[model samples]
Target: MSVVPGLVSITFRQLGVGEILALLRRTGLEAVEWGGDVHVPVGDVAAAKRTAAATADHGVRVAAYGSYYRAGDHAPADFDAVLRTAVALGAPRIRIWAGAAGSADLTTQQRAGVVGDVRRITELAAGEGVEIAVEHHPGTLTDTLDSALALYAEVGHPGLRPYWQPRLGLGPAEAVHEAGALLPGLVTVHVFSWTADGVRLALADGAPLWQPVLGTVAGASAEAGAERYALLEFVQDDDPEALVRDAVTLRSWLGGG
Candidate 1:
């Protein structure tokens, strides 16, 4: 699979849909992952369709539907709507949170519940021709790479994949090592740069980390038979112009610049 640079709409959620599309186009990025919050709310089929149409008109791919559907956090009754929204949005995958509790803090029953919920959701998404990918984020079961692998192993579903990012607290080498370990199940990536203290930095500042991570994923995608994307999720202080530099940096990392 070919790796490409794209934008996650949530980073610029304050902007209108047309403005977001224009920003994406001007940056020469190839795709977008539309967030369910603000950009395309859940259960809003009409809005999703319209956004999908607008994105296509500008010749950009809807990489995935960035849904906030936490597996163990939301009501089971609500998942069908999320799946339907993804289908309407023309997204091949739906990005979701692993569970409400972090892996380290989960009880025995809680772990089982999270695993069962994710497995159920994966099957549900499969029926709709959409894939389920858990977000690698804090306060979720996949907060760390080991837990991410464990979650996938326990769920034991081929349809379940993970969306990885540079884990905040780890150094570049450690982060790359962790990312490499999750290569087998990684489907999407949220790209950004931040210090150990959580201060947002320029994407280019994370080059040492992103370069090897992207290279590893690019090779994995080629053998895995699907396209993978390193989406620019956040820029310095939500600045739009920073995206211009981020786009160039992303292209360079992907060897397209």
Candidate 2:
């Protein structure tokens, strides 16, 4: 039941790597998923190494490399760079998008392309001892539970897994069900709470939802003898200070306090 409290670096896009590391230390977070868009850009092995060293120096682990590599949209060559960065960053996993379009919007050929790309990248990542996870996000194939499951089935690779997050407007019960269904292959969770209308709220406000959600994660991780991260994503008003407050709630929920 090793569910570690961590942060998603993109949560503070305005902050530099050093600043984010300091915030993680100040907040007592154990790990971070560095975003490729900023903190550690794709193909920048030097930056990756530097950030990796700094993270280690600050006593924070690299939970995963949050890469924006769209599974089917880009050439396979592009993923080569992404993998290089993740390897240099010493990340255990690389987070990627299923595709740009929603499941319902994708054609059969489009879906197959995404699936093939996922398989290819999974194999490539496995060679380097790194796992690949698709973002459970809207506007992509993983937007729905059924689609996400089907995509994983078709890819059919143990190296590939799904990163779970409560979809916007999803009720706690439904979120629990989704999390449970994805438990077998769950890698990491993006933790946050938002209103049905998209208003971001404090992590404490979502305790009702997260409490049970994290419980399920703990049980599953224990059963599999694996550790998973509950990484805080965005905070209320995109405020850095909001992260400090949210981290308290997150740590309390994880029984860190």
User: Each model's C-alpha lDDT?
Assistant: 0.88, 0.94
Model 2 — which ten-residue stretch has the worst lDDT?
A: 1-10
Q: Candidate 2 regions off by >4 Å?
A: none
Segments in model 1 whose C-alpha atoms lie over 4 Å from true places: 223-225
**Would you list the clashing residue pairs of candidate 1?**
1-221, 1-222
- Model 1, position 113: C-alpha lDDT score: 89
Candidate 1 local lDDT, residue 210:
83
Candidate 1 similarity to native, TM-score: 0.96
Clashing pairs in 2: none
Among these predictions, the greatest lDDT belongs to 2
**What does each candidate score in C-alpha RMSD?**
1.3, 0.9
lDDT of 1 by residue, 140-184 (tens): 998877888889999998888888887667777887787788877
